[model samples]
Target: MNMCFVTHKVRKGDGQGRVNYEVILEALRQGHYVYIIASELSDELAQHERVIWKKIAVEGWPTELLRNQIFAIRASLWLTILRNRIDLTIVNGFTAYVRSDINCIHFVHSAWLRSKYHPIVERKSLSSFYQYIYTRLNRSLERMAMKRTRTIVAVSEQVKHELKGDAHIEGNRIAVIRNGVDLEEFYPRHVDRRELHLSEQQLYAMFAGDLRSSRKNLDTVLKALVSVPEIHLLVLGNTKGSLYPQMAADLGLGERVQFLGYRTDMATWMSAADLFVFPSRYEPFALVLLEAMAVGLPVVASSNCGAVELLTNKAAIIINDPDDSDALADALLRCAADRRQLKQMGEEARRLACQHSWSAMAAQYLQLIQETALHKAVPLPES
Candidate 1:
């Protein structure tokens, strides 16, 4: 079968790109000619005899908003030329404006735009206004792309529900294929804390995300840490533009919070921590949460996180509202108060993570693609 993968980057490392990378590998293994249309792709895929690379150069675009628009337009134009030659086109959301066979819904901009936690809704700054426009633009394009696609591959149940509600698409048209983690790179490990610059004896929980944004809810985490004095937070992410470090000090959590700017060794940190805390206001699906669990760490997450949907009650402590400091603090305290229970939760988390390796996810994608290709395209009618 001739298959086309449309996404920004398809490489094995981290994030959504890694998802595409794995699926492409599976397609190649099954002897499929993979056509990749994107701004960037892994060298391995580019050099493959069976893979046809259509690289869309959008490096000159001044803003990310402009870059996305340009990529969509260029990729759409290329799709027209490849239309006759293609059997199945698996796209990532609205990366291209062309109609697709399998549209992988990663993050629904429409759902985020509707959330009160959205930066545009919470902040009145000029930057926030620009973000609002960017989101709105993607939401409109995503709706069109989703409705026109025959098979929608939602990365999580949260995204599937939002697609049905936001785009008014039929539930039967969507299939949920949760993202996977790299088990070998992030399973139970013993990394020396002294070498990592973390306290050797301190009982600390971990939090990682874009600290500059309120969406990650670092503010709430800091507030929650104020109450749970016994446990500290090892903050990961760039501190250049982030206010969380200052916010931590302002909240009198200076002693309890250690802002360790972004590091490459996330798996090590997750393994070292007692538990992982990530009460993000909104997330389509967080790979970090999965990686943490793969490292045998119990998670304290909010209901808004799509990854939480994949977890059992014994594997994580799920808080209802991310903004509620009390709830987040209580969840953290639960870990601090009982080490034995926390250890058990971590083991459960590890067991669950074992079921969601990158290989498993890629296999699911290939199965869906093969099954989807057997049927004729039947796009949903506009609501």
Candidate 2:
């Protein structure tokens, strides 16, 4: 099969982009001619023998009008390419590009452009006029894409519910294929916490990913740290943003919080931690949680996290309210006090992690593609 993937752009250290890269490579390994249509393509991805990287301009435009103009032109070009060479087109996030023989699978990451999530994002980022235009326009385009797609893949059931009203997609049409962990890379390893410059006695809590994104709400994590006197947070990833060293000082967390930016060995960091805390406001799939679990670390996560649904009774502690610092602190303290229980829970978490592999996720995608192709044989009635 000739498979085509459409995403924003290919860049280094991007989670979704890297996932797409892996999946594309897997499809290529299966002898599929995988082509990518992106806003920009990195040299690393372009160098792949079986992968074709096509660039189009839909990004870095100053205004929504300008962005849409580029989108229209790019969509036309993308559709032209799809008509000739592509047997099946997998539109990653931006699915409103074109019509194809297969209905594009709208793989939603988060339930964006809705009441709760949209208002929070819009208030934080866009101006009033842009918010109004963006809300209406993107919602319309998403609905159109959802209607036209061959299938919809929700990263989690939480996301499926979040997108249900917004996308108006049929339950059967939307399959839940989660983001998985590379167990080979994420499993328990012998990496010293002291090597990362931490004391052996000090209890470490970890928060990974971009500190800038409000949806992550690292502020809550910082505030929670104040309540737990003995526990220190080792923030793994970039911290040059609103919710980093500045937020730590603002909240008076001070030296208790340490921001370790972009470490090469996340598994090492996960191994170093007593607890993994993810207080994300919204997530389609908390891939980081799986990584943490793979390294035998107990997780203290927000209920809004999509991956929490995958948790076993022994492994994870889910705090429903993101604003509840006390809840987060309490969970952290519980794990800190009980070494035997914590180690047992960690073992159970690792057991769960072993069940989910990238190979399984890739296989699910292959099955979905084959099923969609088979379904395409049947004729559909016009709306």
Candidate 3:
């Protein structure tokens, strides 16, 4: 069988790219001839046996929207030139202009575009307008692309619903395939807080994301943490061009929060922490939540996160609203005051994270694509 994957990137570092990377590896492992049409691919994978990479480099483009458009054109040309050689074509949502067998959706632009917290809705600037156009254009293109594809694979139930309700695709059309974490890389390892910190007595909660945007909801976290003096927050993100550090100081949470800008050692920090707090206003599926859980750290996240659906029982604490600082404060205080319950929840989180390893997720994708090959998939609209 010849399998072709169409996406922008195929590397371990990126989120959506990692999914394609694992799946493609699985396809190769199964002895299938895999063709990757991507702008950027890991060198080792591209050099592997029976794997062909059609590099469609468009990184120099000024904006993401333009780059994607150029990539689609280049990828579409490649597909047309080698259509017969490919047995099945799997594409990420709106990646290429041509219709393919399976469409894997990472994020639903239509849903985010309509979100009250979207940049277009909350902000009024040229940059915000550009984002609106980018999202708006992608949303329209994705609808057409998803419609033409034989199958749709959503990264989460949250995205699945977005396709069904927002994109007007039927519920039966989308298959939920949550992203996987590298259990080996994320597993609990002892990290002595004394090595990086000034305090051994203070319980710490870690949050990681872009600090520049309120979309990640760091502002609300600062607001919530101002009251919880018992628990200190260590934020892992780039502080450059971000007001969060300043915001933390002004809010009188200077002692309560420590901003550790972006670093390669996330697993170490996560392992050292007592809790992982991510209350993003909108998250399709936060791999950080899963990664934190993988390291035996209890999670407190918002219900708006799609990944929250994967968690069951006491592994996570779900806050209904990200803006509710009182609730966030309470959740943090509860974990800070009770060591036994926190440990129990962290252990439970590890137990759940163990189930969603990268190998397991890749195997599921392999089996599904194999099944899809045997039977001709009917497009949801026509079916």
lDDT of 2 by residue, 84-197 (tens): 777777775454456443333323423455536544444753554566566566666666666656677777787677667556677877788777688888887776666778
Choose 1 or 2, whichever is better by lDDT: 1
Worst 10 residues of 2 by lDDT: 101-110
lDDT tens readout by residue for model 1, 186-215: 899888888877788788899999878889
Clashing pairs in 2: 103-150
**What is the alpha-carbon lDDT for the whole of candidate 3?**
0.89
Candidate 2's C-alpha runs over 4 A off are 10-12, 40-45, 57-60, 63-72, 100-110, 115-136, 380-383
* Error of model 2, residue 291, in angstroms: 1.6
Q: How big is the RMSD of model 1?
A: 1.6
lDDT of 1: 0.89
Q: Please give the RMSD to the true structure for each candidate, in Å.
A: 1.6, 3.0, 1.5
The residue ranges of model 1 lying beyond 4 angstroms of the native Cα positions read 377-383
RMSD of 3: 1.5
In order, how many clashes per candidate?
0, 1, 0
Query: Which sequence of candidate numbers ranks them by lDDT, best first?
Result: 3, 1, 2
